[model samples]
Target: MQNPSPTGISKTVIWLMSIISGLVVANNYYNQPLLGLISKDLNVTESAAGKISVLTQLGYAFGLLMIVPLGDKFLRKKLILIDLILVTLSLLWMTFATELWMLYATSLLIGATSVIPQLFVPITAELSSETQKSANIGLVVSGLLMGILLSRFVGGIVGEMWGWRSMYGIAAALMLLIWFIVYKMLPEIQPNFKGTYFELMNSVIKLAKTQPVLQLSSFRGAMGFGSLCALFTTLVFHIERPPFEAGASVAGSFGLAGAVGALAAAKVGGLQKKMSINRIILYSILILISSWGFSYFAGDTYWGLIVGVILIDLGVQSNHIMNQTNYFLLKTNAVNRLNTVYMVSYFIGGSLGTYLASVAWKYAEWKGVCVVGLSMGLAALLAHILFADKIYKKQLNQ
Candidate 1:
């Protein structure tokens, strides 16, 4: 029952999808660890360079809204392949960029084309066995989380050693490699939506309006991811100042803490069979708010930052996993569309977080950034506490 969608998919292919998803998403985050370097090289203020991250996330949100739903209307392999070709080209544009506007243009396009990862995620639920569904999603999401973490670490070292452009060049080459492999190995899966493209999208909007579970899921998701986005974007600036006075590479090393958090998130995903999801969701949001308490003291020591990173990722990803699992349970036929709504909301929060954190960094420095984070974190907790019982009960009856 686990492997009979088209009957040819295997664990190896699943692992490949996980890797490809991570690689494609990495293009968005590489700018994080390199923001200071970009500010210097491009002769812009740190706030100005930070726009690159916001634009990238905004592009991703727009792409999720526009392109990811197409997975339900077309053969997913064909759509994913086309996306990769465009992704490769966009990264090349980043590699060759000499002017600031070129970086902005390429960043948006790169974010748009990187929706290939989202396409793979819906297929995992359909392709894996019922017993293994949560774990398989966990596996692929772990890869995505690792990619986000590692791109920073890699981006910093690569940018520091050679140059930021060189980091883009390497990313482009990796995409090209993955494109060829996807062309050769990926199996075709038929789409479920039969309406015209406009109708398909209209139905998505309807789902967004009607599904309270999705609404609750998306709202808190946005808040949690937004807090994380603020933390990561401003972290480079934060560490580069004061007693630490560390470099980009050291700031990027914070991904290691996130990696540990990612591991905990994956472990939490396996608890779906053993624990109540409401418990998971509540605990995760509390964890997210707790991380900010740790982040406040990061000005004094690196240890606080590391622990905070771990807690933040664990909280965000654990809640993300639970929400996504419930999204799949909403309707088997329109998982892609449900995903589109959820993720668009998720990344929009991220874009706002990036922008606000940059503003906070300008005026209040690290302390102000913590206030921004705490504000968002509290919003997530409030939303969950106010509505979780009534809404989740309604979803169960439905």
Candidate 2:
């Protein structure tokens, strides 16, 4: 039987969802700040170690394509629990990984199972009233953004104090605790689709082809995220050189600045009541361009890097929230599949950005990285300016 619509969602449930979202998404980012440390310990070059970040993101893209669609075909709460178990196991694997290949393989698993946040996003949208939809998603995404930022902060601090492997061990323990909490507290959300897994996956592509807004939003989001990844992936290499010569902890501490932007971006969802999504997209793209401009000029100054990081995150996260809100509103029953299409594209872009940044760092160091980021921002801006007005008019008429 089809489950009855959720009558209401409590603050406690929202908070729980937010925390779970934060924790699950953190699995993808914990390796960013720790990359340098991992490289040193594993006796790999910094450039070689950056591939771990790329592979992890690629794995996430793969999981979004493969596992997230299952959220529609299976019971969501049970599916989430099973994935959390996989995440915990992956963290445990990372803790014991003594070789570079072992770490790479475990990182892929971590990224794949860390897709729990993707499941939670559509669920939050499904549970809320139309008026509260953006706000609730904003709250959940805020937790996600916090996880992304704080993962760097905590990973750096923990890795510094107890070594990188110890950091993974702690993450595994935390995942286990969250697992129990979720199993006990989360309500079972009945499956919306009754199709076979193959049909479910096929529907994802069909939805993307039929939905123009989804395509534009996905493209703009992909570019914004790609730029964001370009900066973060190469940031440690920048700080560890010349005037700064900082440690992993210092690199991770930049996330604090990013955290501020993330919190601010959460409110962007609430602005949907007041602003058009196209306007939000335009402003976000401008902010992204300006952010890379700041970084380009910041050079070795701590203040410039700090300000740039804040702007970059604010720009990217705001764009993300806007894109997601639009897609969620498109199809109530197919929200998870919609998310699968969008998020899979998003992370694939991120993987490419990280890989390009690594290559850029090898060539022109910080300058090359900045150039790559700025170019991506400009490309997104151009696409938005060209296509967004027509799309917005169509959406309004519909």
**Number of the top TM-score candidate:** 2
Q: Per-residue lDDT for 1-398 in model 1, tens only?
A: 12344443478777888888888899999999999999899899898899999999999998999999999999988898888889889999998998888889888998988998898888887777666777788888888989998889999989889988999989989988997888888877898888899999898899999988889899999999999999999999988888889888999989888999988898776777677777888899899989999999665588899999999999999998888887777655788898999999999999989989999989998888889988888998898889888887876686
What is residue 385's positional error in candidate 1, in angstroms? 1.1
The TM-score, computed over Cα atoms with residue i paired to residue i, of candidate 1 is 0.97
Worst 10 residues of 1 by lDDT: 1-10
lDDT per residue for candidate 2 within 1-398, as digits (tens), equals 22324565666788898988998898899899999999999899998899999989999999999999998899988898898888999999999999999988998999988999899888888888888888989999999999999999998899999998888898899899998888888877889899888899889999889898899889988889999999988888888898999988999999999999999999997676677888987898899999987899986799999999999999999999999998888855998999999999899889988989999999999989999999889988998999889887887798
Candidate with maximal lDDT: 2
TM-scores for all candidates: the values are 0.97, 0.97
